[model samples]
Target: MAQRFGGKYSPSGQKPEKGTPSAGPMNTARVTPVGLRANLMFVPAGVLLLSSVFSGAGAMALGLIGAGVWTGGAVMLREGLKAEAAYNDRKVARRPALPRKILAAVLAAVGAALAALSAGSEPLLTPLYALAVGGLHLAAFGMDPLKNKGTEGLDAFQSSRVARIVDEAEAHLASMADAVKRARDRQVEARVEQFQATVRTMARTVEEDPRDLTAARKYLTVYLLGARDATVKFADIYARSQDAQARADYLALLDDLQSNFATKTETLLIEDRSDLGIEIDVLRERLEREGVHLDRNL
Candidate 1:
């Protein structure tokens, strides 16, 4: 499959053959192996690979070995077939090298090699078997923890539409700042500058990882906290301005707060959390302390 540009997939740039139909793979980070390939190949292959136990004398040991070989072989064939099918389907120019297939092929080939090597020294096959089996078990167990370390759910959502969101967000910030500056009021201009700086920080953080979105989230927390502070400071200075301009500055403070909240909403689209409540409470308390009452919902 074609790789994502940002945090999402796009199979958009393609022309299927006249008689061909395209069934794209799940275009997300958490893609499950699906269709027949997953059921027959991935499931069985895993079971068989884990069945490699060599502790018994004859019958049990032989059975376990047979089970392992059967499952491993089947998985390799099935997954390999899946790859071949993908190639045939024109969905992928090359098949992905799943770890299970490589492991199975290695184990099978190594078994043959060890058998030949231990021909005269039959007793030596015991250590060889234990080593191969134990090594694969360790390898399999290690894969999950390592792969799960990246930003959660971000891979599916980042490249979702890079150019569009990036442009939209930046343009919105610029447009709003222009609106403030064009009003030709010093207090409004000052608040707008503070707001734009926070936005720039958020944008920089989001763009840092087109592949990983957690960084963007971190930036948002910083941005919101800073925004909350700015609102309080603006409210304090509001009493000093003339009546109409003071209300304008308060309205401008609301505008800045709105921008912060909107940015947070966009960030939350790719990440989910409950940390926003604390920031809201902080903003509310500061607003009340400054005697600048305003509805803080949305």
Candidate 2:
């Protein structure tokens, strides 16, 4: 088997130079990959389309309709799964606006009924087929999340503000990724991925304590947006010329970005610890004022 070419000199290789600041790790947990199981949902639709060729006119029409519905439901199911994975990856998240999995289930049921009807099944038995299909779909994929995560005891206004800022930051990160693909340099792509990982660390830090959002907002917004714009410009230039100077400058910029983002994340964590300490002190004072005595260690 042929192996991929990755080395210190390869355009896509990631070998850190001496005195370079490491960006921790390049691989980070991301939204679950769309797998073979998810693609299997399309199998029924394919079968319906194939069988339609041998059916009578009315039956063929029903088969075609059933196939379309099945395909649509499968698409919906894949998207719902992706959305759910993103929701799960975050420390704080709101439930999806629409329950796509549930809607997909309904579509599966309807498609099954059409398929059964086209097969000349009795009216009474067609409903049973629909029920079975819907139930099986629900079992395989499950329902959309029913509640928010990490929102308890949080001020609604503050939480919403943090959510909005994080959303904007995520958009910036996405733009950076899209912009860099134009460079078509694997090494540069890996470097950008590392920088993104560092940025997400800060994002998660703010999510853990919305109070940190105030201090970290600039890093998440202005800095991130600037990085994204730089990426777009660099990719455009490098794609045409493959300039070594441009690549070196861009890599240097990434090094600076990773260091700064990592430092900011550490600062946010320290601030969160200080806030916790203050809260604990205030609680202790309140308890003492109420004539409650506690051990010195407690």
Candidate 3:
């Protein structure tokens, strides 16, 4: 049969590849050949010829043998495209494709060889002919396991082993994520401790020297600013927080601070630092603000 299976058509309305939804009649959009099964006909064809040589192969074998060449060619072309796609896909990802492409290439070569044998004129060729075809098919199929791209033959034992490895890796990642969260929590605690220290320092300054309201007031400002920073951090961590009591406590504290920060400290002659964006140190103003009074016990 004179059959032209694949040919390029630059003419208008010609489908670019097979398997395309827009391809016109005859599934012309399907790529010429691209897939694992592309040249798979060699497998059955070689089996047919080899079996026929020994035990008078049945009609099934004959049918498979007749279509072997074209089938293999078609499959190889398609799968070869698949291999190409795999290769192109790795350009940006840097993913290695030696395993899969090698497997696919091995299969393609077997199919090509089987198709090549068809050119010969013989109902059943010499022993080597069928043996070559059969041997190659066996080798090509063997590529699946040898390449280790797919675990088709892995027994239950091997499957369990792989599963264990995956589980262990996931556990390790989870542990690391937990450790990061703990460290972050610790940092927040440190900030809270520092702010509390500033408040205590403010109180002590007033006790040490009743007239040193300037130093005491500066310390209070520091405490307020520190508290504002802590509030922001708490908001970040507690976004979707479900703890009712904790949420209430934080909200109450925020409201109290916001109220205090909005008003000016009469004796200090300055707005509370928390209500403002940043602290500005004014030596003259600090010394002049005598109206501010800090009681150590308060």
- Candidate 2 local lDDT, residue 161: 92
Task: Note the Cα lDDT for every prediction shown.
Answer: 0.46, 0.87, 0.40
Off by over 4 Å in 3: 1-63, 66-73, 94-298
Question: Candidate 3 on 101-173: residue-level lDDT in tens?
Answer: 3444444344434434444335455345555654654454433222322334435454344333323432432
Please list the residue runs of candidate 1 whose C-alpha ends up more than 4 Å from where it truly belongs after superposition. 1-157, 211-298
CA lDDT of 294 in candidate 1? 75
Name the top TM-score candidate.
2
In the range 1-298, model 2's lDDT, one tens digit per residue, is 9999886678999796532434555475354546787799899999999998799999999999999999999999988998788688798888888898898999999999999988899999999999999999999889999899988988888988988898899889989888999999877887787788899888888887888888999999999989999999999999999988888888888888889999989988888889889988888889899998777696
For candidate 1, write residues 1-298 as lDDT tens digits.
9974532234554453221212454221122233453345345334433443333344334445555564565455455544444333331122243654455546554443333332333665656764675465445422211122223444444644432354455455545554544345554555455555555444444544453245454434445445445544544554354456545545655565656555664665445334456667788899889997878665
Report the error of model 3 at residue 216, Å. Answer: 49
User: How close to the true structure is residue 25 of candidate 1, measured as C-alpha lDDT?
Assistant: 43
Best-fitting candidate, scored by lDDT: 2
